[model samples]
Target: MSEANECLFCKIIAGEIPSNTVYEDDSTIAFSDIHPKAKVHVLIVPKKHYANVAELAEQDSHELSHMVGIAKSIADKEFHGAYRLIFNTGEDAGQSVFHVHAHVLTGEVMAE
Candidate 1:
């Protein structure tokens, strides 16, 4: 596991910060978004701290696959056909938190 001093997701995983968790496992967690953009908005993040997808290249391949698999399950079980998976990487892309995460959204299309 990565060092915890500067990671928000790590804190969320350890229950240091409050969150609405939807799914959990040894390596990951899926939770509802506090500032939801849709009827079914969720965030899926790895247990380890990585700043973004690019930083996640060092992690094992299995974790990536499992994250995507979780995303699909969330979509199928929650969205039922109308949803989008978004990963904003930098300031220009709207990423506020400095951690790797997948945003699963549905119910309405977001504005451009």
Candidate 2:
């Protein structure tokens, strides 16, 4: 059920697709967004493919938190002013992209 083959993030992490990687470690990768919602927007993704939040139950807690921690670090580096972190889990939530990722947006509304 984990679409590892067709998953875009999997390709990105695997070096099949080119992404502007700003930060990377064994557990996570931070890259610039192809579509920017603010002055600074980046997608923080786990090295392993996860369809969405619902599928995250199979992932380790340490890796999950590490991804989030990397998100905060990237946001602080790029969007020094302020930022918002969001994740859309399913179709109803507007998750056109199934690769479990955190959207870090800055230069936008505080509540966004």
Candidate 3:
């Protein structure tokens, strides 16, 4: 497994930082976003650190599927089975944190 020394998501996974965790397993965690862009916004991340989807693909493709599975489960319960799963790969794509995470958005129509 890979890890970063200064990654915020790493801290959260380590329990060094507090988060409103919704779901968790040995390999991944899902939590509510602090600054939500939609009514229901959750962040699903892997315990192992990866900078982005491309990095994650290089490291472990299974983890990507696992993260998405968790997101689908969350959406099924919270938003009655309707949601958007997003991955912002770079700053220009709106990715802020370096760690790879899936944004599960629902409960409102997002601007196009």
Candidate 4:
């Protein structure tokens, strides 16, 4: 199978894997994170596969921005529009899944 086919997020996008979907559109999907770091933690992912945030930005900056917009919307509804966005770019940076995604964390005071 191709790398995209083997991707976890790809499977989720394809409905092969179940996910707690929050928002979805033609280019992106937002879902609740299974292992959440914050009270309201969601993942904003592109339907199209990219290795990481940098890769996604290089390939489709518009989609990257859309992901951010979705993250903001989620924060608006879940945490009074106050939130933190995280992009873990590589394995060394704590990104386990190769598929590019943005983590939207909110609902409490963020640790420094």
Candidate 5:
């Protein structure tokens, strides 16, 4: 996937599209999910885009760690120590956006 040309999350990170930003650093940006699956649902994406975890792992695994750290930090503050970090790698896995992201799902209760 050409992230700059087509990825929605890339646009969100670039400020090409607005997002409810929660956390940001040089490497990543964390924001509230527009269609939240949980009370504290958020998505953490890297400024440098990769199509998915495998692509990211092959290209630059450090970016993956950066994204995970951001997710953990967000969960720490928002979930008060409980959350799930999810990565849907492909369409079959429910990854609608090709750009890699970590979905932080939290709150008192979440759907299964």
Candidate 6:
């Protein structure tokens, strides 16, 4: 199978895999993480697959910005507009799914 075909996030975006969708738009989708790291943890993903943040930035910066916007929107609704955004670019960085995504974390005091 192709990379996108094998990608878990791609499957979720395709509706082949079920997800607890929190938000969605023409170019993006936001869903609750299966293993949430925070009280409010959502993964904001682009509908089109990209390997990592660098690839997404190079190919579609608009989507990257849109993902951040979505994250902020989720935080505003779920918490009190205080949020942390993370993009794990590679295995060493903790990116497990291969598809580019932004982790929106909030609702509790994060260890600094």
Q: For each candidate, what is the lDDT? A: 0.83, 0.80, 0.89, 0.93, 0.84, 0.92
| Pairs in clash, predicted candidate 5 | none
Residue 112 of model 3, lDDT score: 62
Q: How does model 1 fare in lDDT? A: 0.83
Residue range 1-112, candidate 3, lDDT tens digits: 3448688999899899999998999999999999998899999999888899999988899999888888778878877878899999999999999899999998766676
**Which is superior by lDDT, 3 or 5?**
3
Give the alpha carbon lDDT tens digit for every residue of 35-109 in model 2: 988777888888877788667646666777787777677666766736787889899998987988888887545
Q: Estimate the TM-score for candidate 4.
A: 0.97
After superposition, the stretches of candidate 1 with alpha carbons farther than 4 Å from their true spots are 1-3, 107-112
- lDDT by residue (tens digit), candidate 6, 1-112: 7999989999899999899999998999999999999999999999998999999999999899888889888888878898999999999989899999999999887896
Q: Better model by lDDT, 1 or 2?
A: 1
What are the clash counts of all predictions, listed in order?
Answer: 0, 0, 0, 0, 0, 0
Instruction: Give the per-residue Cα lDDT of candidate 3 at 25.
Output: 90
**Rank order by lDDT, top first?**
4, 6, 3, 5, 1, 2
Q: In model 5, what lDDT does residue 38 have?
A: 84
Quote each prediction's TM-score: 0.85, 0.85, 0.90, 0.97, 0.89, 0.97
Give the Å error, residue 42, model 2: 0.4
| Segments of candidate 5 deviating more than 4 angstroms | 1-3
> Model 6: what TM-score?
0.97
Lowest lDDT 10-mer window, candidate 6? 71-80
Highest-scoring model, TM-score = 4
- Indicate the residue-level lDDT of 15 in model 3: 90
How far in Å is the alpha carbon of 40 misplaced in model 3? 1.0
Off by over 4 Å in 6: none
